[model samples]
Target: MGSRVEEVPNKQVILKDYSSGFQKESDLLVKSGSIKLKVPEESSNAVVLVKNLYLSCDPAMGVLMRGVPVPGFIYPYKPGSPIYGYGVAKVIDSRHPNFKKGDLVWGMTAWEEYTLIPKPESLIKIEHTDIPLSYYTGLLGMAGLTAYAGYFEVSSPKKGERVFVSAASEAVGQLVGQFAKLLGCYVVGSAGSKEKVDLLKNRLGFDEAFDYKEEPDLEVRIDVYFDNVGGKMLDAVLLNMRIRGRITACGMISQYNLQQPEGVHNLMNIILRQIRMGGFTADNYLHLYPKFLEKLLPHIRKGEIIYIEDVARGLENGPRALMGLFSGRNFGKQLVEVACE
Candidate 1:
């Protein structure tokens, strides 16, 4: 006559309010509440139970947490709710037939131990178990797809071309740089710190890497550009790009927090050089997932491809990990490891 399932304490990171600029730890709080082991009949209409494994804290999350609206783009996070971001998780129960218990998946997950994901269609089911599970949070996930679709599909990369990626040591940037190199192109990347620059060059095998904070003349720095960082970096990259070069606007981490974003000043060169640029988001190429994974997985297993990640423990670290992305504190795919399976 009564529910027999034990109530679990949901330790969740709740956003106190929307952030205007840089977020502080005070912006989020970890509190415990109640959740039933089984979804109620009323709740089972759409809900799927997920135990989050690795929660990705991306540069874009900084923009998402600020609650800003950009036309025709993904909307920002709402205030007083559990912050949702990409994660590698296991579906423990499901109302949707597409998912079932023990299925590993990656998609928008809450910053907590467990989540009730409503839309299962957006989630990608994990099939391979040979690779490290963390890969699903970055290299084998949205960041990897962004690099594949944006650079290869949209920009139409060719062998021997020169490629540049901004924030090169970060998750998406690191993969983009490597993808270009694997295609027999010269790859260069820019980072905010010297350590990241070194990682890009020495560790990730990028052809060249620069610390943008130390370089005052980025225009002169990039002789051939494959621009990822936008805003003023786009302006500088434009001036340096080779004739007829293309740029993929993957993200604009440097400008996310600015109230008035810096503008690109070298638009004229694009016309003069016949340079082409395309802006891309992951959803644009969701159809290409299987193809992209087919091409990328072998490289990953062989160690021909590598990723960088900065992981923080506990859901309480969500704000710090998310905020650190803008300042270049996170070395790679910034994710909060809520649980391990």
Candidate 2:
């Protein structure tokens, strides 16, 4: 006879209420819950039971915290339920054919110890274990794809192009800067603090980096702009864009927490400079994942590309780590380590 599957307690980071203005740590509550170890018979055969290991903390999550409806197909998190985000997990049980027990995966998951993913299509199986498993939450996950698509596909970067990245120390921005460097572009990045600026220039290999808070004037004109921190920084970059510049609007982190988003004054420069600006989501570029991996994996293996992560241990600290992103408190890619594999 086969052994019976057991039910276990699940610790979850629950959203207490919808955010109004800026989000506070108080908006989230870590609570204990319980779940069956096996997928229910009535559940969809596609469902997979995952034991989450790491959870990503992104600025975009703040937008979901707000009760307001968002443009596009994004659904807001329910106030009383566990918040969901990109995460790395181990498959505990699977009714799906593509995955089986003990397979590592990364995708949209609840901020809980265990999650039953209804649609397993979004989950990508982790084939390479040579790199840190946590990277699937950042570098090897959505953030990396965002940088690849934004830089290569959207901006259509060319060698010798002068490139600029805003919020260059963050997950996607860091990768974008590295990608530009690898492309032989003169890359300059703007960071929030001296430490982050140093990381961009000294560690991440940006040709030049500056603390935007200290130097609000983006002194030089550039041919490409990878915008992660939008708002005044974006407004400043607008005035400095060289003619025919390409701007990939990857994110607007600065505006996420604002009650009223800041308006840009230099939008007219787009017309005067004949600049091209476009926004993208990683989901739109998933078709290129295999191609992206083929390119990125070699760089990673050869030490041509490096990634940094700031890990917050335990699910209880998840809220604080998430809130830290807005305050520039997290040093690198902020993630919560829920369990060890």
Candidate 3:
């Protein structure tokens, strides 16, 4: 007789309920479940079982937790189920031909100790492992692609042009600022706290950085604007854009939690200034991954680009880390460290 597949206990972060207003840490509950170690023979489709290492706590996850149906390729997290997001994992068992045991990969995975990916095609195998594996959750993964596509593809920037970034301390925004600087543009960034602003100017190589909370009036006119925080910040950037300026809308973190999202009042400025505005999601530009790696790998190796992360250890702290994004409690990219190696 064949031996039975061993089932192991799995710790997971589960969504307790949907939130329309501000998301609280209590909304997520850490629960323990069990999973089989190997792919079941009776499985109808290709599946890969993986052990998660790190999980990314992005602002987009906040929108998903709200349980509101937004028009996108992604969907909202369901209550009573384990929440999932971008994470770095190691394949322990696989029925998919592309993946095998001991392969490191990153993509959408359940917020658990172990996950069974029914659609393993979404996962990307990790080709380069010389750098930190956790980087796959942010830099060299989702955020990197987003920043590269938004600035180079959507913004259509030119050398010596002035550039502005909102929420400049976050993962994507921080990178956008650095990219603008490398292109010889005069880069300015707006962050929530004085410490973050200092990090932007002193550490991240932005030409200038300001505490947006301190200076609500953003009067600087720029040729390119990277919009991360929408609502009032977007409205301000709209008014200050130079003629024929380009605005790349990457995210709207400010308006994600509100019951009624605040409206932008200065949209007419886009017409007046002949501004070209475009929004993008990284999934649309997956073909450019190799090209992005070619451009970014050198800067990373030479220390020209700096990526910071605020890591929350353990699965239990996942809720707190994810919620910190909305309050600006995290200094950099917020992520959860589920396991080591």
Candidate 4:
């Protein structure tokens, strides 16, 4: 007779209710539930069990918490259920052909400690382990992919071109500035804090970095603009874009929490200058993952690229860490480390 598997407690971060306007830590609740360690006998071969190790906190998650059907999101998080997002996890058991027990993966996962992924194919197997595993939540995962696709595929930057990026110290923006510099473009970045501005110039190698809050004039002509914070910043960039310049609209962290999203006043510049502005999500360019890895892995290994992360320990702190993204309180990529493994 086969031995019975023991049931274990699964700690989870649950959404208490749909958020309106800005989000507070009270919106999320930490709860505990029980799950059997073994998959059901009748389950399909595709089922995979994973122990969640790290979870990424992103601005887009704020939009999802509004109870609206966000673009590229399958559905809104149900009230009283665990919220899900990109995370790094280790497989505890698997019936899938592509994965087995002990494999590390990064992809979509629930906030719970243990998750039964019915569609295991959605996860990406981690092949490179030399870098920190937490990087899967940022540099080696969605944010990195977004930056690569936006800058390379969307912008099509040329050497010596003038490039500008907003919210430059954030996860994706930091990488965008570094990528532009590596490509031989003259890069300038704007951040909300002086510390972040310093990091952009000193650590990330940006040619110039400015504190947007302190700058009186934001209009500065550039050949390429990577827009991470939308609203006024995007409007200012539009006014400054050179003729035939490119703008990659990767995200709008500034507009996510507003009741009425701020409107851009200088879109007419696009027409006058014959500029190209395109909005994209990482999912659209996922087919280029192999190409991105090929280009980025070497940079990471050689220490040419630097990644900064603000880690919150344990599942209990997940709510506060996520809230920090909205307030620009986090220094860099925000993450919750649920477990050591």
Task: Work out the TM-score per prediction.
Answer: 0.94, 0.97, 0.97, 0.97
Which regions of candidate 3 fall more than 4 Å away from where they truly are? 70-73
Candidate 1 TM-score, C-alpha based: 0.94
How many residue pairs clash (N, CA or C atoms closer than 3 angstroms) in each of the candidate models, in the order given?
A: 1, 0, 0, 0
Candidate 2, 177-238: lDDT as tens digits: 99999999999998889999999988999999999889988788899999998899889889
| Local distance difference test values of all predictions, in order | 0.79, 0.91, 0.90, 0.90
Candidate 3 lDDT, tens digit per residue, 148-261?
Answer: 999999999999999999989898999999999999999999999999999998899999999999999998979999999989999988989999999999999989878888
Can you write out model 4's per-residue Cα lDDT over 44-135, one digit (the tens) per residue? 97899999999999887877787877665578888899998999999998889898999999999999999988898889999999889999
Minimum summed lDDT over a 10-residue window in model 4 is located at: 65-74
- RMSD to the true structure for each prediction, in A, is 2.0, 1.6, 1.3, 1.3
Candidate 3 lowest-lDDT run of ten: 66-75
Candidate 1 stretches with Cα past 4 Å from truth are 1-3, 70-75, 219-224
Error of 2 at 9 (Å): 1.6
| Model 2, CA-based lDDT | 0.91
Summed over model 1, clashes come to 1
Q: What lDDT is reached at residue 245 by model 2?
A: 96
Candidate 4 Cα errors over 4 Å, as ranges:
none
After TM-score superposition, what is the CA distance of residue 104 in candidate 3 from its true location, in Å?
0.3
Model 4 CA lDDT for position 250: 91
